[model samples]
Target: MEMDEDPDTLPAQRQGNIIITKYEQGHRAGAAVDMGHEQINIGKYANHLGIMQETELPPIRALEVKQRRKESKRTNKWLKMFADWPKYRNTKKLSQRVYKGIPLAVRGQAWSRLLNIDKIKSQNPGKYKAMKEKGKRSSRIIHRIQLDVSSTLQNHMMFIQRFGVRQQELCDILVAYSAYNPVSIPGQRYSWAMYPYSAWVSPEGVSTS
Candidate 1:
């Protein structure tokens, strides 16, 4: 096989990346900004600020919380028996602080303080309200990302195999994306797949055509 010329001079792949410069810090798409790609709203990512914070709960403190909440309800036998709510509530300052450092939980209500629960919820309230509604999507580069999905992050790829994100989110975004841009589905490019409004593309890399 013949090797192509300098290869070094080939136009850099368009992709997305985190940029840390003297003036600003943020994720930038590869070599150039792709205006055509559908961007996830800033607020969705911003709402996860608590994931980076620190928490201060000793292992023992957690157990103590369960015990205390259990003891607090003694007014009625039924109430005491039904006092399982404390195991779930966050009245204790320690628990409140602990959730700060823990990985983000999927149970929406529990992670409220940890992340901007209400704010994020409010931002996408309509999507959540419509149980059948789909997730936001992007048709900008589904083919490109799908090509790389298998080789990208093991976690993402593996999760995509096992416990993938709810399909509706991707569906809604892609359907809407198709209307905005005309990229075909990865391997199924011949068939024009129309996604719902909520389907969307994640800004994972910077690659331009």
Candidate 2:
């Protein structure tokens, strides 16, 4: 079949320049051959401070992590046994286990027990709900946090779909936690509470965007 003549030279309206091509017609609706699409900014593409990046890896190193994870399963016995607080009160062993990194399956429970989250939760019933209520009332922080949370880890699988379940949960937790600890420098008065707030986007060190 015949192709259209050079679109630039063709007598057409300036705004409606049309160069019909097979690829453009079949796939992208408005990607006319003669249309000049502006190049996206280099900074936007390169400025991935918190975003994950692809990396080449040594097979041996990858295998070692995999092996460690497998061995971590054996430690589940100790992890479960530690739940009985009366029988096990060795802080050093607990610290060592934490340093080794608890298995993902029981990590949440282990952390809760280690941090005495249960005691705090029990002592302050509905405290988390109260913080969430406060967060909802604070429109300014909520708006800002919503915007930031929506963009956080935008390239990751969990966050790729904006406002997805995990993203919403992350946003809620952040907002609630901020309200729970409404202090810029938590350690200013406490002497040892100088912990800066930070978050890890993805467990895997790569963005599968």
Candidate 3:
């Protein structure tokens, strides 16, 4: 095939109408519909999992990563030594000392040869699909951390108070995690429900002594 042949014109790379995702080693419970046109299926997921609820999303700063991977404390000590290169370079001849302020261009072919972030992402759909398939068939309990994290009780409070929807949807996330990683919760502690205005009353007469 030619480089610009447009694989969307081909047959095998069509998109499907059904989309389902679930943790590996469990049952399929979450499904989504793709009612739009079936376009190119090169497998793009750059913004698929854009949900920002998790704070551990990887940083996107190149310089930050570079600074982090720098070897010595004195390595970037001269990072700002020639910071004003644009102002000085025109008046003075270019030299190796002003290399810190230089901006480099990234070549597409060079990127393809060096790192393959695209290929790794493109493979996720198949992996997620397979995980859903396996998870639906197997039996297990989800974990407590995921249960708390995915719960609608606190995070989805606005959604519940506004649209009155997604309570079950959020609960399902917790349920899935709870089922996948079940731990023993001893029946010793009692939980309570407090009204918003309950702080006004005094607990002086209600003694537990």
Using TM-score as the measure, the top candidate is: 2
lDDT for each of the candidates?
A: 0.31, 0.45, 0.28
Candidate 3 residue-wise lDDT, 1-209, digit = tens: 11224565233212110111222222222322211112212123122222223233354578866654553332343333235434533343334423433221212222232234346537554553343334232313222222332342332222212112232233233333233333423331111121111111111111111
Report lDDT (Cα) of residue 83, candidate 1.
48
lDDT of 2: 0.45
Model 1 ranges off by over 4 Å = 1-96, 103-112, 127-138, 155-209
Q: What tens-digit string does per-residue lDDT give for candidate 1 at 23-61?
A: 123223441322322243332322222211123223446
Where is model 2 more than 4 Å wrong at Cα?
Answer: 1-69, 183-209
lDDT of 1: 0.31
Residue 60's lDDT within candidate 2 is 49
The candidate that wins on lDDT is: 2
Off by over 4 Å in 3: 1-117, 142-153, 156-209
Candidate 3 clash total?
Answer: 15
CA displacement after TM-score superposition, residue 79 of candidate 3 (Å): 27
Clashing pairs in 2: none
lDDT of 3 at 149: 26
